[model samples]
Target: MQPIILENVIKNYLLDKIQVPALKGIDLKIDAGEFTVIAGPSGSGKTTILNLIGCVDTASAGKVVVGGKETGTLSEKQLTDLRLHTIGFIFQSFNLIPVLNVIDNVEFPLLLQNTLSPKERRERVLKFVDRVGLTQYAHHRPSELSGGQRQRVAIARALVTRPQIVLADEPTANLDSVTGQNIIDLMKEINQTEKTTFLFSTHDHSIMNQARRVIRLHDGKIQANA
Candidate 1:
């Protein structure tokens, strides 16, 4: 099954009691293990599409299927479970808990799911933490880490769950060019090695160049898929 599918999807936001269209008739599919980027200028619906596929938001019209399950059909609890179990999100802001140390942050998701023993969770968390090159900083809090290091912790946290699809929204936006490129390379390495399907929403040309496939969006519609 494909990792993501959006069929004639549309999303609207209520602004000042008026409906503002975010996505317009979006029909897209991302296969298993594909590293793809949705490139667009600001307000082009890139985030909207990502949210739909990530199950953070639903379509106002049409269907969104993630990891073979139609999001529209799932209950709120099921949707939460799907997001927790099937999707990983990397935000540009590096949404790590400032008070939590690196290892604790990475282990948070496992704790939430409560499916693994403490020993198993620690082992899994450490594996991903090392994969992201942050094992040395495992005991450090977010404030103690550099921008790039904090982002690395975020990446490890996202992967510790071993989700089928990882969604990154402008993941490199806040880093310097060199750090951003390094982060992209690190994610690419993980994508290749772990065969994790990655879908990124970014306007960064560097990320677009690194992506295996680029889907360009404009004015809330797909302009090109190449």
Candidate 2:
């Protein structure tokens, strides 16, 4: 099954008793193991699309099918379960718990699942942490790390569950050019080696250049998908 599919999806938000349309009939599909980007400026509905696919929001019209299931038909509990088990998210903010160290932060997601034993959880967390090249800073807190390093922690945390799909929202917007490229390369390597499907939303042309496929959006509509 495709990791993400949107068929004539529309999203509208109420603002001051008026409907503000965010997405205008967006039709897209992201195949499994594909490295793709949704590129657009602000207000072009990048985050809206991600939210729909991530099951954080429902579509106002049409369908949003994720991992072979239509999101509109899923119960709240089912959506929660799908997100926890099938999808990983890496935000631009690096949403790490300030109080948690590297190991604790990465282990946070696994704690939600009962399928893994404590020892197994630690092993998975350590495996992802080491995969992101943070083995030396496994004990460091978010405050002690650099922007790039903190993002690495976020990557490890997102991947610890071994999700089929990873959604990154402007992940490199907060880093320097060099550091941003490094982060992109790391994600690309993971996408290739682990065969993880990656869908990124960014306005960074540098990132667009790195994507195997780029879907450009403007004014809440698709401009290109190539």
Candidate 3:
């Protein structure tokens, strides 16, 4: 079954008095465990699509479905729960808590759900920290880590929940070319190994080349899906 599906999905934002349509109408289906990239120039709605898929925003019209659940109808609390349970997000800026150490930063999402005990969370956090080669820096805070290391922590955090899907919005934007490539490779390996569906929103051709399938957006609509 497809992990994600969108049928004429439309997302619009109210900027002051104007209605800025970020996604005009989109129809897309991403199969389970697929590595997909949504590519487009800035202001072309790529990030908007990612936000919708990640359940950060609701579609204005049509359907946005994830894990066989219809998205447009979910309540805010339900959507939040869905995001927590089914999806993981990697942001471009690497949004780690300033005060938390690396291990705690990675375990923070699980804490939100209050579903796992401290021992379980530690086990989960260590597993991913090792996966991302950050086990040695477990006690270091975000301030003590380099950009690449911080991004690793971000990736570990994204996967700590064992989410079925991961949505990355310009995840490599702040990294150097070499480090960005490393992050991309790490994501690819993890997706294949863990059977997690991966999707990225980026204009970087380097990233597009690495992705198996690419969807291009333009002016709030998908221009090409291939």
Candidate 1 lDDT score at position 187: 89
RMSD of each: 0.8, 0.8, 1.2
What TM-score does candidate 1 get on C-alpha atoms?
0.98
Model 1, 14-84: lDDT tens per residue?
99999999998999989989999999999999988988888989999999999889999999999999999
TM-score to native of every candidate shown: 0.98, 0.98, 0.96
Residue pairs with clashing backbones, model 3: none
- Alpha-carbon lDDT of model 1: 0.93
Error of 3 at 216 (Å): 0.9
* Candidate 3 local lDDT, 77-195, one digit each (tens): 99999999999989899999999999889998999978988898888889999999998999999999999999999999999999989999999999999999999999999999998
The local distance difference test score of model 2 is 0.94
**Best-matching candidate per lDDT:** 2
Pairs of residues at least 3 apart in sequence or in different chains that clash in candidate 2: none
Clashes of each: 0, 0, 0
How high is the CA lDDT of each candidate model? 0.93, 0.94, 0.91
